[model samples]
Every structure is written in C-alpha cells, then in structure tokens.
Target chain A: MKQTQTLNHPLDDLLRTDRIPHIWCPGCGIGTAFSACLIAMKESGINLAKTAMVSGIGCSGRGAGYVKLDSYHTTHGRAIPFATGLKLANPELNVVVFSGDGDLFAIGGNHFIHAARRNMDLTVVCVNNFNYGMTGGQAAATTPHLARTTTTPMGNPEMPFNLPLLAWASGATYVARWTILHARDLAESIEEALQRRGFSFIEVLSPCPVNYGRRNKMKPMDTLRIFKEKTLIKNNAQPTELGIDFERGIVLGKFVDEDKPSCGELYDKTCRPSLTQGTAA
Target chain B: MEPAVLTGEHYMTGDEACAEGALAAGCRFFGGYPITPATEIAETMAARLPKVGGTFIQMEDEIAAMAAVVGASCGGVKSMTATSGPGFSLMMENLGLGICLETPCVVVNVQRAGPSTGLPTMAAQGDMMQARWGSHGHYEIIALSPSSAQEAFYQTILAFNLAEKYRTPVLIMTDEVVGHMSERVVIPEAKAIKIVERTRPRGRKDRYNPFEPGEFGVPPMASAGEGYNVHMTGLTHDERGYPDMSVECQEQMVNRLVGKIRNNLDDIIRTESHRLEDAEVVVVSYGVSTRTAYAAVEEARELGIKAGMLKLVTVWPFPERQIRELAGRVKGFVTVEINLGQIHLEVSRCAAGLAPALLVGHCGGTLISPEAVIEAVRRIV
Candidate 1:
C-alpha cells in the first residue's frame, strides 16, 4: 500500500497514515464505512479540534486508532458510555462512537440503549457485518436467523437485531441505515446526523467476506451485488419492517430525524440551579 | 449556588465526606451507579457537581460508570466513581482499561462482605488484595484506606492527588462501617487544601507522545479534543500511544507502568507508626479494623506486653519494607481485619518468617472485637 508515496490521499489529514495498512481483512467493508465517517466528519465543518472519536473492540473499533482526531479505542461494548462521559464532561466536544455490530449490540447493548434513551448528543455509527468478524466469524447479536457462523455451524436460531428499530424504540432522535456500497448516501446521512442535535444513530451494512460471506456461498463481489441489487431506498419507512433480507429487498434511508433536546441541554435545563423552565433533578 | 467545597464543621457520613473531598480536590466529574454503603457518594455528587459546573452521571452499571469516569478524565476532567464489592468487581475490566491508557481517575470501593453478595449492608476487608491486583494482568496500583469519616475525607482528596500526579487509577478502599458511620468532619478552606492539577503535555502539539514519561515517571496527559491527535488504547502501546504488539513493546510498557509507582514508594506509602519505638509486638491493621487494633494494643501494653499499632494509611503498595523492617525488631505480629485473612497474608509474606504474623479475623458482617485482637497479640507476646 505504501509503494506509491507520491500519491496524496484526500483523507490523509483525518487519518493516522503511520498506522496505515490497518487490521481489516481483504474483503472487509469496515474501511469503506470508516472512510465515509471521516468524509462526513470533514464535510460537516464542525470544529475538528473539539471532536473526539471513541471505538470498542472489533474490526470497526480499530477505526478510533486510525483516526487523526483525539481518539480512544476503549474496551469491548463500552464505546457509547465512554463517549457519553466525554460529551457530558465537556459539552463543547463533538463525541462520536464508531464500532462494530457485535461490540455495540452484544456485550455493549445495554450502554447503547441507555445512551439513546437519554438522547445524548452523540453520533454513533455501527458497522454491521452480521458476525463477530474479529473473533473468527462467531455468531453475533446481529446475525440473521438461520445464518451460518463458526459458533453456529447448524445455522443461527436467533433473529438479528433490527438496529434502526432498536434505536427508534430506544428514543434516538435521528436514525439512518446505508450499505458500504452506497458510500455517498452513507456519508450524507452521517453529515446530516452530525448537524442535528440529540442522540443520532446510523447503521452501515458492511460485508465481512472472510467471515460471514465465506460461511455462506457468497463471495466479496456477491455481497457487493446484494448491497447494490437487493436493497431499496425507502425514506421514513416504518422501522418495524426495516429488517435485512438479502433476497427480499432490504430498505435503507434516513428514517428518523427530530430536533429534540439532547441529554446535556436537558440536564442543564433541569438539573442546574438557574433553570427558568422547571426542575426534576 | 452551592460551592464545591463546604468549608466548615459538619456531622456527616464517610460517604458524604468523601464526596466533599473529591469536589475540593477539583474532581469535576463523577459517573457512578447506586450501591449499598457507597450510594451517598454518588447522590451527593449528583446534587453538588452541577452546581459547581461539574458533571455527575448515574450510568447503567458499574462497568459503564468506570468507563465513563475514565472517559471524563480523558476529556480533561477529574473524574471519580463509588461502588460496593459487586459493583467494584464489574468495574475491574474498565479499571484495567484506565490503567492501560494511563488515565487518571478515582475509584471508591466501600467494600462489603462475601465472595458474592455476602452481606451487602455489612462490612468486610476481604477486597484488600482485589484492589491491588483485581484487574487482569500484572500492574502496580495505589490504594488508600480510611479508619473514620474524618480520614475518609482526607483520603479521598489524597486519592485524587495521587491519581493526577501518577496519571493512573487510584482506589480509595473504605468499608461499610466507615462508609456509613456518621462522624464529625471538618472541611478545610479551599486554599488550605493542596489540590494537584494534571500536568499538561509540553512541546509541539504535532510531535507529542501521550505515554512518554515526564519528570517523576508520569507522562503529562493531553486530554481528548486538544488537537494533539493522540491515540489511546487498552492494547500494549508504545510511548506514542499507538498499539505495538511486539513482546519488547509489552516489556517496556509494563515495566515503566509498574516502575512509576514502585520507584516512588516513599511519596505514595502512608502509615501511622504509633508507639512502635518501644513496642516489641506490632499489630498490623487498616480501615475500621485499626480502631479495634489500637484499643487492643493499649490493653496489651497495660498487661506488660509492649505492643503497638501499625496503621496502614495506604494499603496497595503493601508497605513491605516497613513490614520487613518491623519484623526484624518485633518478636511477632498480630494482624487485625474484618475478613478471614487478607492483609495478614501480606504481612506474613512481608514478614518473611523473621516474625510470626498471626491473624485475628472473621468472615465480615461484624468487626473483630478489641478482646480478640488483644488475645491474638498476647499469643504473639
């Protein structure tokens, strides 16, 4: 990758080029999703100096290490709370939690829901590859029903989490979903989420070819074809019907966006002594 | 507006005093979950932090609380959390993360009885060793224990100071008795309290290394969002704070972390050497057990057995050298604690067979009376 030293990468300013050749596998989609995030972060025109990225343990969790901003690669399932602390401690900071599906939904599921419930001013991007890619393609909380994995050789009996629906039910003020193939739409959605207030969640459907794809008959190209051919762009679609079905078209778009008061704003209004509106503690 | 420091005399529980102490120490962030014997610290922080322009969050669990505390500290805030044994157990994973990242924060473990929910409302000193090595992997930790509410306030401040100075997690090991017991505590003036601020990174921001040690073996911390573009991880990393998976990198990282505290034992270790000059039998104790041990030592002295109390103010480094030195002079040692035998093991190991360290202990829920401690001291005499 370093053979062409003269070529300048557009995202160089946002990347730790020294830690290039990241740990992502050959056909992994994390890099594409991460690039979208960086582009969105840059395009949003927020104070980059005041923005911090936090990630948990996984393929996508490694994104925090590669980011050029002040970043934290936290423990598994904990990126959300760590980001919450960063945001709440200093309201001036724009905290972003970027991690994989297993890290956010499995071990760190409780934190994800609570952060959303509080309507914290955070932009959370979950890269859903349908399995624990880092741990040898084991079954994950987001693994589709009857999907094959290392841990579930007989096919997964558990139904995958509908991430957008979960975020909706958990009171996220903004929610969207896009695949790695739709990088422009995903980046636009992320930029929109960054501009909006309150807890914003965006799920990127990325392919884990070495792990999830190899178990099924799908290869890297086949997964990309599914992302392109077998998806529907349905804006404001009902969250309950927003499940991922490879053969039956999976719906994707900006689903929820509202200008609700974030956790910090509400906390200042309610908990502080100089509240003019009211008080609940 | 309620000032962070309430400078006056007040009758309050140890937990409340500890909260006051943390506020006075410039701890502007507290993320905690409610647990028995330590809930007051969180409650007080929640009420007081916002008034002082700080932040207090009741997280979903102790793990999140610990993670949030570390995150707040990394975000340029002095952060803290309080919990019981079970919650403290949950915090171990993230506490290790804080240690690995060299993030400064304070954790208050108001320990209770049992291996699992033994007696949530009761007291125990069983987690003494857990505070030192509870987190996975071998790393040095600083822990302080308090015998009374007054001491709890001071120790909480000290915990923050040590955390800032060393750029590591500091544990305040108080138990159910001291945590819940109400006593007179005098909050000194803000100017009187010696608060330690974090040492900022010095040099060009573009060329900064987050983990490179400064003057006393502690790296100057650059909190998140300052534009240094620093990276922090739980994996073994180089001085630049990027992951370096080589075995050599692991050795350098671990050695410097352990050596940082080990080299400054004099500044970190705190103990009260009472009546040891003329005493032949020394009673090793800490936390609330020190109260009973002091009475026992005086009783033993009344009966012509020269005994003294060695009050361990800071317990994590274990004061091994002091124990070894005392072992040479004292004929024997009597260790007092509420647990079956935690610190006794340390005293015995440090004593190194030069002195016989006998344990007067029980399985928590109650304290070993002065009579039992005295009996143990008599056996040693």
Candidate 2:
C-alpha cells in the first residue's frame, strides 16, 4: 500500500491532514466515498464558511472529523437530528449529515424518516457497507438477506431496507444511489443534491472487505469487480425495485428529484399569519 | 439598545415563566418535545420564539429534541429543551454527549411521578438523584430546583448563564406543581437580566483548540460553519478536541470536567436561609417542598421552637458546607421533599451525626403538607 506524501496535495487544506492515517482499513471503500464528498463540497461552489457536516458513530461517520469545515461527530444514530437542529437554528448555513447505514438506518431510523417527511433542507450521504464495520462486522439494517456477518454467522435471514425506496417513500425531494467505483458520477450526484432545496439523500454502495466481504469470501478486488459487473445504471428507475443482489445485477441511478417547499419555507408560510400578527401586536 | 425583556407582570405557569426567562437570557434556539407537566414550556417557546426572531422546533421525540438542542448550541446559539422524567431518561444519552463535548445548553426536567410513567399530571421530586447521576458517567452536573413560578423564571436564566460560564449542561429540576401552577411573574427589562454568552475562540483558526481552558477553566467555543474544522466526540478527547483513548487521557478529561465544577463550588452553589442566625432547628428543602417547609418553619417558630428554613436553589452541589455548619450549631434538621428521603439522605450525609436529620417525605402524587413538615421538625427538635 502506497501512501500519498506530496507536499502540496490539493485536499490538504480542506482535510484535517494532521489527523491523517485515518482509522479506515486498507481497501475500505469509506475513504473513497469520503473523498468524493470533499471533492463535491469543494466543486459545488457552496460557501465553505456557511457549510457544516455532522456524523454518527461508524467508519463512515468518521467523515465529519476529517472534513475541515465546521463538523460534529455526534452519538450513534443522531447525526440527522443534530444536523437538523443546526440547519433550523441558522437557516443561512448549509448542513450535511454523513454516516453509515447502521448509524443512520438502525438506531436513528425514526429520525431519518421524520426528517425526510418534514422535507428538512439537508444533504444526507449514507455509505452503505452492508454491515456494522466499526463493531467487528455486526449485522446491519442494510445487510443483504442471506449475507453472513459476525452476529449472523448462519447468514442474515432479515431482509434489508431498500434505501432509495425508503428515502422516496419518506418524502425526500431528491434521492440517488451510486457505488464507490463511480466516484465522478457520485460526486456529481452529491453536487446536485447539495444544490437541491429540500431533503436530499444519496446512498453510496461501498465495500467493507474486512467485515462484510471476508465473511462471504469476497476480497476487496472481488467486491469491486462485482460492483462493476452487477451495477446496471437505470436513470429514473422505480426505487422499490432497486435492491442489491451479489449474484444478480442491481439497479442504480437518480431515482427521485422534484421541487418542494422545505420545512423552513413551509413553516414560514403556514405560520406567517400568526407570526405577523404577533409582531404587529 | 432596547432590552429584549417583556418588562411586565403577568399570570403564568412555571413553564411559561421559564420560557420567558430563556428569552431574557438570549436563548434563540428551542428544540423540544411535548411531555405532560412540561409541554407548556414547549408551547410557550413555539409561540414566543418565532416572534422574537428565535427558532423553535418540535422534534420527533425527547432524544431528538435534546440532540438538536446540543446541535444548535454548537452552532453558537443559546439553546434549551424541556421534558419530564420519562422523556428526560430518553435524553440521557445525548446529554452525556453534550457534557463530553462541553457544550453549553439548558435542560428543564419538570419531574412527574415515576418509576415508569407513574403519574403524568402529578408532581414528584423522585428525579433528584437522576438529574445529578442520570447520564451514565463520572462527571459533575449543575441542577437548580425552582420552587415557584417566579423562581422558575429567574433560575432558568441563571441556568443558562451557569451553563455558558462553566461550559456544562445545566438542568432545571422543577416539579409538576411548580411547572403547572400559575402565579404573578414579573419579567424585568433585558438590561436587568444578566446574560452570559459563551466565549468564542480567540486565536487564529489554525492555532485554535476548542477544549483548551481559558481564565475560568472553560474552553472558548466555535460554532459550526465558522471555517474551523472542529472534531468533537463522546470518546475521551484532548485539549485539541481529538479522540485519545488512554487512561491518562480519560483522567485528564474527566478531572477537568469534574474539577471545573468542583473548584467553582462557591460560585455555583446558591442557598436561601431564613432566620438561621438564632434557630436551633434548620429545615432543609427545595422545589415545591420548600413552600411547605417555609410555612412549617414559621409555625414551628410560633410554637416556641427555634426553627429556620434552608431553601436550596442550587441543589446538585448539595450545599454540604452550609449543611455541615448548620449541623454544628442547630439542634436538629428536617429535610422535606416530595420523594421519600432523596434530599434527606444528602442532608443527613452533610449533617454527619452532629444533629439528627429527620425526613418529612411524601410519596408521589401530592405535595408534602406544612403540618407534616412541622411534625418532622418537632420530632427532630
């Protein structure tokens, strides 16, 4: 494994390079997803001074600490609400929640649905590695059915959440899915989502070779190859049918995008009469 | 500049007064969930916050409300949330996170009767111990017990100031009666309200450390979206706010957290004493029980017993020095509370056998009667 030691690395200033040698293991796709986010954040032309990132506990949640923008590494399953508070408190700030599937979908599942249902103006990037990577590969909500994990040595019998479908059904205004192999496309999707007005979600299918892959006898390269062979790009495809299957192909693309009044905008609209009345009085 | 205070006398419940107090204290962000006995605080905030250009959010649950409060505070706004015991329990996890990150926020637990949802509308001081030790961890906390609607208003402002000064989570431990009962509350001009804002980071962004102690042992704060890439976590962190999982690191972090409050005990602890100079019996009490204790002390005094009342405003630090000194001089002590012997145990421990500390405690659902407190003081005397 080669480490980048260039003096003038373009991402040096944007990252907490002093905390370099992050905890992500080699071949871990979380780093790839995190890098893409940084690039997207930099390229989106958004005000870095008015942007903040929040994350929960997990390998992917570590993304917040690495980003140089004002960031918060909150408790497990809580990044979404934390970001929600940050956004609502100061509407001028652009808030993003970056965390893993387990943190966002398991303990924080209720918060995820409600934030989406409210159409909170937030950009949520969920890195779905199929299992709880930080906790020695425990089974997760997004773990594929029949996939083996530390907690599920007999193979996970529980079906997983169709993340894109969940976001779409939960009233997300924009939703998309991409794998780590599609970094450029993923960054572009994230840029678009960041520019969107309401609740936006993007699921990055990343490999956890040390956790989910080792149990299934799939090496890092093998998982990458599978992603290349099985991911079929289908723009505007139905979100309910976009489930992942290792042996069979998986559908991926921009599934949902629409204009909608965000929570802040709607709040002002709904309460304008009373608010104005109180102010006048 | 015109002060933000409403500057008027009005009839309001303790919860409503608390919201007014928060507004006077410059609390611009309120994230809360509706729970019985505490829901009025949220309602008042929702109605008033927007009018004041502050933000009010009704979160999905108590936990989210707490998490959002911390988040908003981290965003450099004075933030608060209110809940009952059941909801307060749900907020414990995030409260610990707030403590670890040294975030300044106010949490109002309008306590109701409970082992688990015991009585939603009824009052209890059962959560006295919980407020101090509720969140799992070995760190000191600041909790204020307000006995009336007026004190609820003033103490809530004090809670936010203490939180900012110490850089810790401040708990307002009021009960259902005080939370619901309406009384005349006078809101002073905002100029009269002394608000303590969190100290912002001083040095260059590149050289700044979020957890480095300043003059008062509290680190300066930098809110989110200010271009300082801050990394905060529940894990034991260093002065630079980066995780360092070592025994030495834990000791340093925990000691600063606990010591910052412990060393400032004189400044953080507040108690009101009535007629203690010549009294032989000092009845210790707080929250709703203080009203009963005051009346009981007066009655006991009229009955030729030298009784005085000790009203605890800051209850968590326990006011041990005052109790111990009173124990040396007073004939005995009577501790009154809604729960059975929560503060009584603390009083007794502080008394250290210098004088007998008898408990006049009532089980949940009703307030302790002044007669019952008078009886307890009579027995102790």
For B1-381, candidate 1 gives per-residue lDDT tens digits of 578789999999999999999999999899999999899999999999988888889999999999999999999999999999999999999999999999999999998997998899999998988998899999999999999999999999999999999999999999999999999999988999999988999889998999999978999999887889879999999999999999999999999999999999999999998889988899999999999999988888889889998999999888999999999999999999888888899999999779999999999998889999888787877
Q: For each candidate, C-alpha RMSD in Å?
A: 2.3, 2.8
For model 1 the TM-score comes to: 0.98
Task: Name model 2 segments beyond 4 Å from true.
Answer: A1-7, A272-281, B1-4
DockQ of each two-chain model: 0.75, 0.57
Q: Pick the candidate with the highest lDDT.
A: 1
Clashing pairs in 2: none
Superposition error at A241 for model 1 (Å): 0.4
Global Cα lDDT for candidate 2: 0.90
**Model 2, B229-268: lDDT tens per residue?**
7778887889888888899999999999998999999999
Tell me the spans in candidate 1 whose CA falls farther than 4 Å from its real position.
Answer: A1-5, A273-281
The value of fnat for model 1 is 0.77
